[model samples]
Target: MTAALASENLASADAAIHLGNVSKVFGKEGADGSYRAVDRLNLDVARGQMLAILGKTGCGKSTIFNMIAGLTEPTSGTVRVSGKNPFSDFDAFRGKMAIVFQSDRLLPWRTAIQNVQLGLEMLDAPPADRKDTARQWLIKLGLGGHEDDFPHALSGGMRQRVSIARAFATNADILLCDEPFSALDESTAGKLRAEFVRLVKENGKTAVFITHSISEALEIGDRIVVLKRPAMIAYDVSFNTDTSAEERTLIRGRIGEVLAA
Candidate 1:
């Protein structure tokens, strides 16, 4: 592997999410119709780390996301979450991981609190516990009074907040987000991003946020992994809140160059 790939595959024994030499091919491999979306990609997300994966559309971002989410298996290599294979051990992850999709994905008939309780319901949590957990998350996400409102009655931003509250209500240790805030207006998205980062930190959750937006990645990730076609890592960098603005600007420029190439 190249030095960049080596860095991309940095060893982390305590990694919350690990993908080693993972490749995903749709259709028959080496056949005419086969498509390799991910090619020997390697990544390690340490516990409590918020990783932003940036790439253009059709760069296999969703393929990688599905693999990590245990929705799809890789054609080769291994995908492990908390030291277990995510694909083979899907059921073992129940209540251990949660996802926030691009769309709010709330059921129109369900109230905000009811939507938030969905995950808890899947976990078979007690009725009282589910209600309490859902209510707490809604309040934390600034939807206290809106909890009883149905999805159609809420604004776009409020619906997304309910989705986020749902994800956290499960008390999952890992979060997989696919441009969850991308649909909202910039101001709303920015606020949600800040709230997301804060909640992830405060809850000590490891998150992999997939986005095509460089600005979103820069704002949310302590570690940013920029991928090229076939989902190979092109650049890997880490920065924190204490990072200098000048340095961040330089990193942003570098990422732009990589993507432009």
Candidate 2:
């Protein structure tokens, strides 16, 4: 078999997240008023892989994210996480999947550590255990002394650090990030991106990060999938830390060409 075909089969057999012939429509199918956000999109992400999905605005990136998060049901075909329907078995994934959004989304009234403990609270973890886990995550994210500060008292980067701490505190196996660092200044975003990639690798988490920036995707993803309008995969490539800079530049140029098309 072709190497690409063999790899595809391996992904299908052991994917942590799978979308098979998945399509999502906002209104009735085959109707004039309806809008199809995804068109028979099939994707497979293996365990512990970091997949960056690059797309233009209104290309249904968020729609695909929602479907994977179990917040939206597909119009046809199947969406599976660890071999189960995330939408139908939403409760089963409560502590198994965590999301980090563009905004920090921290509670105003809660202190940094408390906010980090939010997910653990849902799991009914003991208060002491929750506090310890939250504190450790905060420390790891460089928020060591700021754990007592409220959201309003922190800077944007610091607040997003707390958000990252919260997501990791749950120890979820799968992390879905929707441009989590997009709102920060370039310097801060760059720092956080490096830290995010490190944490994901260290924790052995499967991540699907959606981004509009090709540079960010290149920096964060081991495998990058660029999408066109209607959420179709236009280009897919995989690279690693061992990949040479020249190859990366070529990949970037190819991605730019695809996006421009």
Candidate 3:
């Protein structure tokens, strides 16, 4: 038992996320009408790694995230995060994992600093501590002077920055982003994307990023996983800062071919 435990722990260190032969079926099959959102999917994401999950619309990408986020259960197989069942241990992950959705999702009434402090509040941090943390994050995200501004008074990009700051302020063990920058204009998105990559790498937090754009995945991911219809892995490839421009173009072309298939 000691040997098995050691092995499992070691594996967890190597991969913060593990899903084995996971399948999610909604309803019964045949006449009952079943929908197989994900089928026999397998994925392993290493610790401190940023993984980009790329898929087109209706490819069941969100289903996979729902399972990981402990929002839903898979009909068959298993899903684990840092070696623990995310679903069975949903409460255990409260402040340990943070998610950023496509939209800013900021509270209209809360000031930027107030919004950033919300997560720390939920995590039960003390008043002074939370305030300091929120202020630091807002400054880090380039909103120091605007901390007192309400979401309604901020621009789209600034509101999104607050949302990102809110997530970072939690200092979570893992970050899950679902098309977070897609709503922004290309210039704003590109700028934020660069900052995001730097922050994630510097913090060494494990992350799973979901996006429909192949280029975005390539830009941000240490590893890219492409999913086909029914959420099956079509491409799993490693990328690095050292990857040349020609290589990047080739990789993009390959991903285009895979998605087009």
Candidate number achieving the greatest TM-score relative to the actual structure: 2
When sorted by lDDT, best at the front, the candidate numbers are 2, 1, 3
lDDT tens digits by residue: candidate 2, 58-174:
999999999999999999988989888999999999899999999999999999999999999998999999999999999999999998999999999999999999999999999
Candidate number with the higher lDDT (2 or 3): 2
User: What is the model-wide C-alpha lDDT for candidate 3?
Assistant: 0.90
* Clash pairs for candidate 3: none
Provide the lDDT at 98 for model 1.
98
Worst 10 residues of 2 by lDDT: 5-14
Off by over 4 Å in 3: 1-13, 29-31
Query: Residue 65 lDDT in model 2?
Result: 97
Output the TM-score of candidate 3: 0.94
For model 2, the stretches where C-alpha displacement exceeds 4 angstroms are 1-10
Q: How high is the CA lDDT of each candidate model? A: 0.94, 0.95, 0.90
Provide the lowest-lDDT 10-residue window in model 3. Answer: 7-16
The local distance difference test score of model 2 is 0.95
* True lDDT of residue 222, candidate 2: 98
Residue lDDT tens for model 3, 1-261? 799878865775567888878999988754467889899987878889999999999999889999998889999988998778889999889898899989999988888999999999899999999999999999999898998999889999999999999999999989999999998999999999999999999998999999988879988998999999999999888978899999888889989999999
